[model samples]
Target: MAQPTTSLLCTGLSFEWPDGRPVLDGFHLAVGPGRTGLIGLNGAGKSTLLRLLAGELTPTSGAVKAAGEIGYLPQGLTLDTGLRVDEALGVRAAREALHAIESGSTDQRHFDAVGDDWDVEERARALLDRLGLHRLGLDRTTGELSGGEAVLLRLATLLLRRPDVLLLDEPTNNLDRAARERLYETVAGWGGVMVIVSHDRELLQHVDQIAELRDGQVTWYGGNFTEYERTVAAQQETAERLLRNAESDVQRQKRDLAEARMRLDRSASYGRKRSVTRNDPHIVAGKLKRQGQETAGRLQGMHTERLEEAKRKLTAAEEAVRDDAEIRIDLPRTAVPAGRTVLSLDKVRLPHGITADLELRGPERIALVGRNGAGKSTLLRTIAGELAPLRGEVVVPVPLRHLPQRLDLLDDKLTVVGNVKLFAPGAGDNAVRARLARFLFRGGRADQPAGTLSGGERFRATLAALLLADPPPQLLLLDEPTNNLDLASVRQLTQALAAYQGALIVASHDVPFLRGLGVTRWLELDGELRAVDPM
Candidate 1:
């Protein structure tokens, strides 16, 4: 394959948090002109790298060089709700200049501002239409748009900028299926150097290469996400094999060392016995003993060195093996009887003109899905009793828990165990710690402050607190739980939910994840609840 032109480069990059927690140390990366999917575990500094490349963040040491202008879309994008769509798209000044010039203003500044963007509005509108945001007129304020729409709008702004280097972090987190498809198409058609930090498998499929950030280094994998997985799997297999071989070698070395020690002891004993039997002279016997001792010492040193070398190889091999732990919890307490009524919603009218009426029984798994701004979250919040229905009754006789997208339930100041204890006040520390261990927060990990956790760790902590509550949640509500989650974290969550015996209503746009949930029913929330075929 031909090498692409280098569009972005980072050399000797280093960064640390305010608290002296090192994130990246002497990291180096060079991205060329093509779509590169940047993937890693939650706190691997993928986002931080993008920020450094975009100049949004300054590295503690090293340099970032970009061939041209850089456009960045952060993971947690929060637009100024007061700004107009045109302003957000960064074309407001150009549009105003064009309008002023057309109105017969001969201002030099207007001409200067409109220099080459006379058709800026037309281009902006066209881009908006392409992103499914045409209905959101340029005059509309950002407050009118949904979270997904805001993400797309931010993307449109970057697209309009036409930068040579583009960095997008979790662009599809809030996007629905349709919006995600649109974003996927955009990624597929991206011409310049684009580096996307995302866990969206569909979006990753459009990338030309994968740049995995792990342990403060970048490992390049040619082709897309599937190819990356295959490559990594093969690499891991080889690593495991090497590790086994290394272990075998170490054992053999140990055996050889033991045998050598035995031989040395026998030789010493035989030498002593021969000297006694022969009645050799004292000086000769002493010399013989010293010679035997020297030979034994040399043999022992050689064997020890070999053993140490084998052990070092074993360590290296072990390091090559990946250990992405998954959540494994047995929550039998969360189980509901087959005929039990878990929840009931009657003529429930939620915000954003959404209405839902449904009855959940036993441990039915329902997948709630809809387009961006379709009020899927609203319905969930209403069902979770976080929001009051406009005009209807919501009832949940059984214990319930809600894992919102923001995961705000966790208190940052508290430790993971402390947070879980708060939810399950009656549970002793031993019990809470034992349950948290199942969530992968073992030993010292459970004592880490919630605020200091990585994205995946935070999710696990939040889930632990929710699932390990006093009265086990029989009906659990999860809103886009996979958003911002790494692939391993997603798998961990899937495993946890798989073992969950309670009824689940998960509002998510991740079709693969939803499918894996063994959803018994598919519901779409578009102004009202309606049964939909499995996506």
Candidate 2:
């Protein structure tokens, strides 16, 4: 059945801080049906604008008008304590309304009663099962699930609403590949308007239009993320051309003005008075003075105009650079080669704890692939020392770091520089700052708390620190490293890994990345360690 349509429009949407600093001014958006991607650098107010449209906050000035109900999933889903997966959504409110109609509390006596939606739970189970989630576990307290699981549960609940408008904030953040694909499929098949704030370039490829919030205003681009990138490059090229022409004009004007000044001075020196044409010499001198004044005025005007043009061009150039993605990574050289023993599983059992033993080594970019909660992260954690094998021994011969799918090792409050510093001691403060700059944390960014860095930046910082470690680690364990990165970063990291000499044990849902990295070994973490057909 076709769903209801909702329209939203905002005009002159201005907002300011308590100190009178303006955050938004005359911001306007015309939103109708279809999917739109919202993106911007940190603190561009994407989340704030989303709140304004969702009616969660009133604009300080201007208006936000929407036609119907809006369903929104906030940036973070904080479940009620001890809530079950199916029950944490707090859908009881909606269920109560349905119950009220069924009980004739909503004027049901004059109309048909609400049919039984008891099947709703069944439908939910089917969706969960399709995504490889445990249906029986739905009744279990959600607090027991991993961060990835919790996020998936919230998404599932949001979909059950079937609202006319859907708003999601970084919806795929914690999902593995299979879960991410499942969520993407659901969004693609959804029959409503959606506004998403995400940095996942691949996911944004499906958006109808790309809307970006920058410098206190929002700009929209027609087409997917790739199209947006192409458009941005074209704009940069045009700006560069304009800047060059303006610069040339300014230079020419300066030269002409200099010549004009010299010519006027020479005329004054030669004829202090107008050519002694047998006229009042003082009158002639006055004419010369007037002429000099005229010349000076014209020259000043030219200079002023040139100055203004130069300022405009410079502003455009600066804005373009600021808006551009300026990622520069300086990964440290590893002193130690990635050691040979990458992984070892002896009689390792997976899901329901069945199993076999396996040994791994360098020259292997092995991927542990499985459905969600199929022990992919678990096995990686076991290798990382976060989990102990129940009946087998997993040994490591060299330094290793685990990129937790949840990034638990990252300190949320500290800056990336601070975090990297924690990894390396005795590196001078200047050295630390310089190291951060290599990972695109130059200037004020070095002071930014680690908690604030984008997912991609966080991973980059971690990787950089790993490289900087004394006698750099020989083994790297990554769990879904590409989950939150843009396409450009993904490619850069992929290329880096291909050139890296260290052994890699990666558990990723990104098939392309694994294939590109020449990962030859396959370990499917179903419950125990088992060697699968080599990829």
- Compared with the true structure, all predictions reach lDDT values of 0.89, 0.70
Tens-place lDDT per residue, model 1, 413-475, is: 998999999999999989899888888889877888787776667888898899889788999
Question: Best-fitting candidate, measured by lDDT?
Answer: 1
| Cα displacement (Å) at residue 471, model 1 | 3.0
Best by TM-score: 1
Alpha carbon deviation, residue 417, candidate 2 (Å): 4.7
TM-score of each: 0.92, 0.75
Worst 10 residues of 2 by lDDT: 329-338
Q: After superposition, how far is residue 188 of candidate 2 from its true place, in Å?
A: 2.6
Q: How many residue pairs clash per model?
A: 0, 10
When superposed on Cα atoms, how far off is each prediction in RMSD? Answer: 2.7, 5.6
In terms of lDDT, model 2 sits at 0.70
lDDT of candidate 1 at residue 448, scale 0 to 100: 80
